[model samples]
Target: MTDVTLMDFHADWCGPCKTQDPIIEEIEEDYDEVTFEYVDVDEEPDIANEYQVRSIPTIIVKNEEGVVERFVGVTQRDTIEDALSQAGN
Candidate 1:
Protein backbone atom coordinates (compact mmCIF):
# COMPACT_ATOMS: atom_id res chain seq x y z
CA MET A 1 0.00 0.00 0.00
CA THR A 2 1.18 3.48 -0.83
CA ASP A 3 -0.41 5.27 2.10
CA VAL A 4 0.03 8.71 0.57
CA THR A 5 3.46 8.96 -1.01
CA LEU A 6 4.67 12.02 -2.88
CA MET A 7 7.83 11.37 -4.81
CA ASP A 8 9.82 14.23 -6.26
CA PHE A 9 12.30 13.43 -8.98
CA HIS A 10 14.99 16.08 -9.20
CA ALA A 11 18.56 16.82 -10.17
CA ASP A 12 21.17 19.09 -8.58
CA TRP A 13 21.84 20.97 -11.82
CA CYS A 14 18.15 21.68 -12.43
CA GLY A 15 17.27 25.32 -11.91
CA PRO A 16 13.54 24.67 -12.07
CA CYS A 17 13.76 22.09 -9.33
CA LYS A 18 15.68 24.50 -7.13
CA THR A 19 13.05 27.15 -7.77
CA GLN A 20 10.32 24.69 -6.88
CA ASP A 21 11.94 23.45 -3.66
CA PRO A 22 10.47 26.03 -1.33
CA ILE A 23 6.97 25.40 -2.57
CA ILE A 24 7.35 21.66 -2.03
CA GLU A 25 8.84 22.20 1.40
CA GLU A 26 5.83 24.33 2.26
CA ILE A 27 3.53 21.56 1.11
CA GLU A 28 5.46 19.09 3.26
CA GLU A 29 5.01 21.41 6.21
CA ASP A 30 1.28 21.76 5.55
CA TYR A 31 0.57 18.10 5.03
CA ASP A 32 2.09 16.25 7.94
CA GLU A 33 0.37 12.98 7.12
CA VAL A 34 1.70 12.94 3.59
CA THR A 35 5.12 11.33 3.18
CA PHE A 36 7.53 12.99 0.79
CA GLU A 37 10.43 11.29 -0.96
CA TYR A 38 13.09 13.06 -2.96
CA VAL A 39 15.08 11.12 -5.53
CA ASP A 40 18.06 12.65 -7.26
CA VAL A 41 18.03 11.50 -10.84
CA ASP A 42 21.79 11.73 -11.03
CA GLU A 43 22.33 9.59 -7.98
CA GLU A 44 19.26 7.36 -8.03
CA PRO A 45 18.96 6.18 -11.59
CA ASP A 46 17.07 3.06 -10.62
CA ILE A 47 14.33 5.03 -8.92
CA ALA A 48 14.08 7.38 -11.86
CA ASN A 49 13.72 4.38 -14.12
CA GLU A 50 11.09 2.82 -11.87
CA TYR A 51 9.07 6.01 -11.95
CA GLN A 52 9.77 6.54 -15.65
CA VAL A 53 10.91 10.07 -14.93
CA ARG A 54 12.00 11.95 -18.04
CA SER A 55 12.53 15.39 -16.51
CA ILE A 56 13.47 17.12 -13.31
CA PRO A 57 10.93 18.54 -10.89
CA THR A 58 8.46 15.79 -11.54
CA ILE A 59 5.94 15.27 -8.78
CA ILE A 60 4.18 11.92 -8.49
CA VAL A 61 1.39 11.62 -5.97
CA LYS A 62 0.44 8.07 -5.19
CA ASN A 63 -2.37 6.75 -3.07
CA GLU A 64 -2.65 3.50 -1.13
CA GLU A 65 -1.91 0.44 -3.24
CA GLY A 66 0.78 2.44 -5.06
CA VAL A 67 -1.61 3.86 -7.64
CA VAL A 68 -0.45 7.16 -9.07
CA GLU A 69 -2.95 9.97 -9.35
CA ARG A 70 -0.97 13.11 -10.21
CA PHE A 71 2.09 13.08 -12.42
CA VAL A 72 3.37 16.34 -13.80
CA GLY A 73 5.79 19.22 -13.49
CA VAL A 74 6.26 21.67 -10.64
CA THR A 75 3.02 22.11 -8.71
CA GLN A 76 1.66 25.04 -6.71
CA ARG A 77 0.39 24.99 -3.14
CA ASP A 78 -3.32 25.12 -3.90
CA THR A 79 -2.94 22.43 -6.56
CA ILE A 80 -1.07 20.12 -4.18
CA GLU A 81 -3.53 20.84 -1.38
CA ASP A 82 -6.45 19.96 -3.61
CA ALA A 83 -4.74 16.81 -4.73
CA LEU A 84 -3.96 15.76 -1.18
CA SER A 85 -7.46 16.57 -0.09
CA GLN A 86 -8.88 14.41 -2.81
CA ALA A 87 -6.43 11.64 -1.97
CA GLY A 88 -7.50 11.81 1.64
CA ASN A 89 -11.10 11.34 0.62
Candidate 2:
Protein backbone atom coordinates (compact mmCIF):
# COMPACT_ATOMS: atom_id res chain seq x y z
CA MET A 1 0.00 0.00 0.00
CA THR A 2 1.19 3.50 -0.75
CA ASP A 3 1.74 5.73 2.27
CA VAL A 4 -0.28 8.91 1.93
CA THR A 5 0.07 12.18 3.80
CA LEU A 6 -2.09 15.28 4.02
CA MET A 7 -0.31 18.46 5.02
CA ASP A 8 -2.25 21.51 6.12
CA PHE A 9 -0.22 24.72 6.20
CA HIS A 10 -1.92 27.43 8.20
CA ALA A 11 -1.51 30.09 10.84
CA ASP A 12 -3.40 30.68 14.10
CA TRP A 13 -4.76 34.11 13.20
CA CYS A 14 -5.96 33.11 9.73
CA GLY A 15 -9.73 33.11 9.47
CA PRO A 16 -9.84 30.84 6.44
CA CYS A 17 -7.49 28.42 8.13
CA LYS A 18 -9.88 28.31 11.10
CA THR A 19 -12.66 27.44 8.70
CA GLN A 20 -10.61 24.66 7.18
CA ASP A 21 -9.72 23.10 10.56
CA PRO A 22 -12.93 21.20 11.20
CA ILE A 23 -12.89 19.80 7.69
CA ILE A 24 -9.42 18.47 8.24
CA GLU A 25 -10.47 17.08 11.59
CA GLU A 26 -13.38 15.28 10.01
CA ILE A 27 -11.10 13.88 7.32
CA GLU A 28 -8.75 12.64 10.00
CA GLU A 29 -11.46 10.44 11.46
CA ASP A 30 -12.57 9.19 8.06
CA TYR A 31 -9.09 8.48 6.69
CA ASP A 32 -7.35 6.81 9.56
CA GLU A 33 -4.77 5.17 7.30
CA VAL A 34 -3.51 8.48 5.91
CA THR A 35 -1.09 10.58 7.91
CA PHE A 36 -2.20 14.11 8.70
CA GLU A 37 0.07 17.02 9.54
CA TYR A 38 -0.91 20.49 10.68
CA VAL A 39 1.87 22.99 10.15
CA ASP A 40 1.61 26.43 11.71
CA VAL A 41 3.08 28.97 9.31
CA ASP A 42 4.33 31.12 12.15
CA GLU A 43 6.13 28.33 14.00
CA GLU A 44 7.18 26.38 10.94
CA PRO A 45 8.05 28.96 8.35
CA ASP A 46 10.74 26.78 6.85
CA ILE A 47 8.34 24.00 6.09
CA ALA A 48 5.88 26.47 4.60
CA ASN A 49 8.65 27.91 2.47
CA GLU A 50 9.60 24.44 1.36
CA TYR A 51 6.08 23.88 0.18
CA GLN A 52 5.97 27.45 -1.21
CA VAL A 53 2.82 28.23 0.68
CA ARG A 54 2.01 31.92 0.20
CA SER A 55 -1.64 31.64 1.14
CA ILE A 56 -3.30 31.40 4.51
CA PRO A 57 -4.58 27.87 3.99
CA THR A 58 -2.67 25.48 1.76
CA ILE A 59 -3.55 21.80 1.68
CA ILE A 60 -1.14 19.36 0.08
CA VAL A 61 -2.01 15.72 -0.57
CA LYS A 62 0.95 13.50 -1.30
CA ASN A 63 1.91 9.84 -1.38
CA GLU A 64 4.98 7.65 -1.92
CA GLU A 65 5.15 8.83 -5.51
CA GLY A 66 4.96 12.61 -4.89
CA VAL A 67 2.41 15.36 -4.44
CA VAL A 68 -0.85 14.15 -5.83
CA GLU A 69 -2.82 17.34 -5.33
CA ARG A 70 -2.69 20.81 -3.80
CA PHE A 71 -5.42 23.22 -2.66
CA VAL A 72 -5.36 26.84 -1.67
CA GLY A 73 -7.85 28.85 0.40
CA VAL A 74 -10.94 27.18 1.91
CA THR A 75 -11.38 23.80 0.26
CA GLN A 76 -14.38 21.54 0.62
CA ARG A 77 -14.21 18.17 2.37
CA ASP A 78 -15.25 16.25 -0.72
CA THR A 79 -12.53 17.85 -2.78
CA ILE A 80 -9.93 16.85 -0.23
CA GLU A 81 -11.32 13.35 -0.01
CA ASP A 82 -11.13 13.05 -3.77
CA ALA A 83 -7.52 14.11 -3.73
CA LEU A 84 -6.76 11.59 -0.99
CA SER A 85 -8.44 8.88 -2.98
CA GLN A 86 -6.38 9.83 -6.03
CA ALA A 87 -3.26 9.59 -3.92
CA GLY A 88 -4.09 6.00 -3.03
CA ASN A 89 -5.30 6.65 0.52
For model 2 the local lDDT of residue 41 reads 91
lDDT of each residue in 1-89, candidate 2, tens digit only: 47899999999899999899999999999888999999999999999999889997999999988899999999999999999988984
CA-lDDT, candidates in order: 0.80, 0.93
Per-model TM-score on C-alpha atoms = 0.87, 0.96
lDDT of 1 by residue, 1-89 (tens): 22687788889999889877898999998788889999999999999888888987888887875645555667787887776767766
Evaluate residue 82 in candidate 1 and report its C-alpha lDDT on the 0 to 100 scale. 72
Residue 7 in model 2: lDDT: 99
Looking at model 2, how many pairs of residues clash?
0
Give the winner by lDDT.
2
Model 2: runs farther than 4 Å from truth?
none
lDDT of 2: 0.93
Candidate 1 segments exceeding 4 Å error: none
